[model samples]
Target: MRIVVTGGMGDLGSRVVRLLVEQGHEAVPASRRTGLDLTTGAGLEAALAGADALVHCADDPSQGDFVTVYGTRRLADAAAARGVHLVHVSIVGIDDHPMAYYRRKLRAEQGIQAAGGPATVLRATQFHSLTAFFARTLTKGPVTFTVGDTAFQPVDTDFVAARLAELALGPRPTAYARATDVAGPDVLSLVEVARLVRAHRGASAPRAIRVPPVGRLMHAYAESRTVPPPGSADVGGRTFAEWLATQPARLTGR
Candidate 1:
């Protein structure tokens, strides 16, 4: 099978591409770097040409809806027209979330559903790297700030990439369908995350300072909206601590 992965050179997309190649599939990556610009739908038809499956991993939240929303819709429509199976990666708990990015992601999903094509939407929790970055950002020196009972079940990126590759290789649905959510094995509070991060760097655990959830976005996280309910998702991945151990002692950018 010939698979086209949008943003194929990106962190997640690259992993998916590698997995697909390992399975003996022809994997093609399409992005602006390769003359395939999703924001303007340029080179979309050419990218999808002869594509048996397409993994939608390209997204730029910083560009607002240009890439996250319209770009996704454009790709979905084109794939549907070409009778190609579209596999899209999404975030969990986007429904009813106040964050702008999450809202746009939900809109992207709706667009894919309305595209009337064979598509699969896989919603996973935050990746481990992002979770660590959050912990580092919320910690200042020896004090770690927390909002309400905010916690995370950060999934491993490798696990997500493998799943996307499997979905691309699996049977295509007649229309848009959602697969079971995926997540990490354990849920850790904000303070717990901070402690693990500090431990990884051989630093003392930061003093946790609990703060009120003052805004919609903070409140959503306080309620653990990003975490799928127990038994609601297919959880399989390295624990956050396990993943952290494999990383450099001094963490860098997300």
Candidate 2:
């Protein structure tokens, strides 16, 4: 199968591409870096040409709606035209979230559902790197909080990617199906995660981090609104601590 992975060089997309190759599929990486620009519609049709499936991991968190919502609609249209199956990566708690970014993601998922094409939606919890990003950035300050009041199931990207590839390579489901939720093996407080990270990094002191719930998002997270409901999740085996052990940069707060 000739599969095209949008944002193939990105955080989660790269993992899917790697697995696709390991599984003996032709994984074509479509990204701006590779001259497949989605914004101007340049090289999009060609990149999607001859593709048996498309895994859309393309994202620009900073750009929000422009990249995620509208961009996804465009990709879906193109994929539909070419009769390519699309597998979309989404977050777990997008439907009832208060944040604009989550709203945008929800909109993107809706677009995929309404795309009138062959597609499967896979929703996963937060990635380990997202937590590490805050941890690394907050280390520069005297004290930074990991939103300890909030809780999240931070799954490994490779684990999520493995599921995506399976959906993409195996079969093309009909459009408008409910998404599947994939979460981490364990749920931990942000503070607990920070402490473990600090210990792994071998920090001299604990002056760099704190545990506090500040934003509305955090409040929702604390209430378990940011994750899937109980018994509604497929849990992976790799814990945050296990994933952290393999990442030297993340462990060291780099």
Candidate 3:
């Protein structure tokens, strides 16, 4: 099978491409690096030619809703024209949310459904990398600012990618793949998370400041939006602690 992966150079996209190639499938990596600009539709004709299936993983930074919604519509139309199957990766709870990004994702899903092509929409929880990135970015010297009481179910990128590849090969099903309730094996407040990270690195303790709107969102997430129930079939492995343990050691710049 010839599989084309958009945003193939991205963190998740690269994993999908590698998985497909390892599975003995013809994997075409289409990204800006490969001269395939998904936002502009450049090189799409050549990139998608002869593609049996596609994993649409393209993302626009700065919350470009139009690019994500409309760009995906174009991609779906092109896939339909080529008679190729599509596997769309989206965030969990998108269908129930009114957020701009989530709304755009819903529109993308609708576009794919309207394309009249075989399609599978896989909505996954946040990635562990995203959580880690947030953790690192929110830290300032010895203080970490965070949305207090927020919950997250962050799955491993590799697991998500593998599941995507499996979905790409299997029959189309509107299935949702969630990650383990990834709260470091414990549900801790933002302050607790900051403390844990500081203790893990043997660094000085940091103060955790909870902001307002973000904290409200976090509270909502903790209430019901995030954290899957135990033994849920949709959830997969690697508790947050396990995921953190797997992270590569940091290097001090010389």
Candidate 4:
């Protein structure tokens, strides 16, 4: 099958494309890098031509609201017109949350559902890379407290890519790949995550302060979201420690 992956040049999208290619599918990566601007529907027609399915991975860094909501609508419309299947990669807990990003994702889901196209929605947890990005940015002079105690199930992006490829070839079903509430294979407070980073990087240990309210919504996520049971098929094997090991080398170009 020929699959067109929007945002194909991005970290997640690139992984999806590579996995599809490895699975013996013709994967066309369409993005601004390839002259396809999903927001305006430019260069899409030619990019999508002869494609059997579309993996909608396009994202707008500054304005996720416009891109996720409207951009998805346009893609859905085009897919319906062409009678192509769509595999939508979404974030977990989008419908239950009211965040701007999450709301836009919900809108995208609605758009795909209403388009009457063969579609599948796969919502996964945050990627380990996202956590590493936060860790790098929020740490300042030996203390990091912005993330608070909120829970996160950070998955390996490669694992997510593989699951997306599988979905692309299978029947359309709304599937949620619940990542192994993946922490360092051990439950840790926000402080601990920071401490681990400091130790790994050979930096001075930073004090981790707990902020009040710490954003209750995030707290709810931390408490409930990272509790997937043992042996669940939805869980991936890579641990947070393994993810962290790769980060320092990648960051330092070592």
TM-score of each: 0.99, 0.88, 0.80, 0.83
Q: Write the per-residue lDDT of candidate 2 for residues 1-254, one digit (tens) a residue.
A: 99999999987889999999998889999999888766666788889989999999998878757778888999988998878899998888888788888899899888987889998888898888786665555555334454545567788888899999988887687675555699988876665666667777786434534445667776665576766777898888588888888877434322
Local distance difference test, each candidate: 0.95, 0.79, 0.70, 0.71
Cα lDDT tens digits, model 4, 1-254, are: 99999988888899999988888889999988898877798887998899888988888857766678888888888887887878888876665664567778888888888887778777776676665555655668787765446555567778778877887787654422222222223334455556666777787778765555446565554454433445432767476667788775434311
Model 2 ranges with Cα > 4 A deviation: 135-148, 204-215, 249-254
The superposed Cα distance between candidate 3 and the true structure at residue 80, in angstroms, equals 1.6
Report the error of model 1 at residue 54, Å: 0.3
- Better model by TM-score: candidate 1 vs candidate 4: 1
TM-score of 1: 0.99
* Per-residue C-alpha lDDT of model 1 across residues 151-248, encoded as one tens digit per residue: 99999999999999999999999999999999999999989999999999899999999999988888998899999998999999899999999999
Better of 2 and 4 by lDDT: 2
State which candidate, 2 or 4, has the greater TM-score: 2
What overall lDDT, based on C-alpha atoms, would model 4 receive against the true structure?
0.71
Instruction: Give the RMSD in angstroms, all C-alphas superposed, for model 3.
Output: 4.1
Give RMSD to native, each candidate: 0.6, 2.7, 4.1, 3.8
**Deviating ranges (above 4 Å) for candidate 4:** 146-148, 172-188, 214-233, 249-254
Model 3 stretches with alpha carbons more than 4 Å out: 139-148, 172-189, 204-233, 248-254
In candidate 2, where is summed lDDT lowest over 10 consecutive residues? Answer: 203-212
